[model samples]
Target: MKREMKEQLRQVFDTPDTRRKEEFLQNFNYPKATYREFLFRQIGYIRKRVWGLSLVLILSAFAVCKIMKDNDATYSMVWVISSLFPLLALLASTEIARSSSFRMSELEMTTRFNLGEVLLMRMGILGLTNAFVFGIVLFSVAFKINYGCLQLGLYLSVPYLISCLGSLILMNKISSREVVYCCAGVSCFVSVFNGILANSKPMIYSDKFVFFWIVLFILLCIAIVNQGSKLIKKTEALQWN
Candidate 1:
């Protein structure tokens, strides 16, 4: 029985197509193509909106500050808050892309691909593309704010990237609307928390926060990947029916 089990295991591992299928499943679980398409679509969708929103917010804050002497601090606070436009843009893009792809996949149900696989591909593409865009934004912000590029990128990129991954995990389980609202709420909370900590204690070691954040990020990533893989297998089985 031991020898028979070993032989069976060897056959499973040695089969080329089996290996290929395994790889395909792995890629499908993460869905790079879908993610890329989502990212590009999102960038285009937000291009106009970000600029307009930023301008409006900045101008409104400036005007308010000039108009009210006692409210100057509040106006300045509002202006600082408005700097989260980029994060908002990302969240909006995620909603639009996921919903559009879900609808499109439903229309093409006759195709060889399964809905779960399609969704994974879309989300993987989105995650990668958004990561790239976020990196660029980080660099730009660092330069504009006169912060050290390496340090600022380390602090901001880590959380933002993790958040994007979390968004993907959330996307798989929730409707597009819920995903948008959830991302917005979480992003706001993180931003506010970070801002408060940064302003209140300049000398605080952020290492502990970074460590916990990374641990949670890894766990969430694993959960999403596992759930996505299971969904694809279930969808594949259902296709036979």
Candidate 2:
């Protein structure tokens, strides 16, 4: 019985098809094999277009602010909104790039490639892109405000990061176009709510409110991570080419 079992094990191990599949999997597991160069290329193509539009919006907002200043109502609400726009734009662009890449991968599913690596690369690229854009906007805003650089940076960075967290969460679930529309809607709603709240007398400026906001932001980050993980899992399960 022992000899018979040993022969069966050897047969299984020496099977040509099994050996070929193992070799194929070894090659497929290579980092370069799963890197998704097309996604990076797409991101590069979109970079110039995104920056051009952003520049136009910034210039227009500056011009409008200059006009408003002459009339003594000069704080550019437009610029403030623009600061938040990067978070939305980055998320939308990344989603588009990722979706295209995933579609291509689905087509390439027969190749010995892992989807998880592609997802990680996408997320890394998105994070880096947003960080660069966020830094530029923070510098511009600080210069415009003529405030102490440190103080202005703090205010701008925190909210921008918060928005980035929100963007990541939203992108995980929506298409690029849907992200754009949802951001627009959320911005409008937040603006209205803030306007109303600002005009009202504050009954609470307590530590509890500060703590509450912190907790909420933390929850948002957690949600973003969870959603991103789900997206990665779903894409993997779909076994996209």
Task: List RMSD in Å for every model shown.
Answer: 11.0, 6.7
Best by lDDT: 2
In model 2, which runs have C-alpha deviations exceeding 4 angstroms?
Answer: 1-42, 45-48, 57-79, 82-87, 90-105, 108-114, 144-184, 187-223
Instruction: Go through the candidates in order and give each one's C-alpha lDDT.
Output: 0.50, 0.52
lDDT of 1 by residue, 120-226 (tens): 55555545655555455554444344335554445554445445555555555665455666766656665666567656764432444555545655675676567
Cα lDDT of candidate 1 equals 0.50
Clashing pairs in 1: 31-120, 31-121, 34-121, 34-122, 35-121, 35-122, 35-125, 35-126, 36-125
Residue 120 displacement in candidate 2 (angstroms): 3.3
Stretches of model 1 off by over 4 angstroms after superposition: 1-93, 96-105, 141-150, 175-177, 204-241
Estimate, for each residue in 1-241, the C-alpha lDDT of model 2 and write its tens digit.
9999999999888856445777687677444533457566535735565556656655654665456556654234323544455444444444434454344555444544545555555566656765565566556555555445454444334444445555555656674456655655554554444335433623322234555545655676676677667766766766755
Worst 10 residues of 2 by lDDT: 198-207
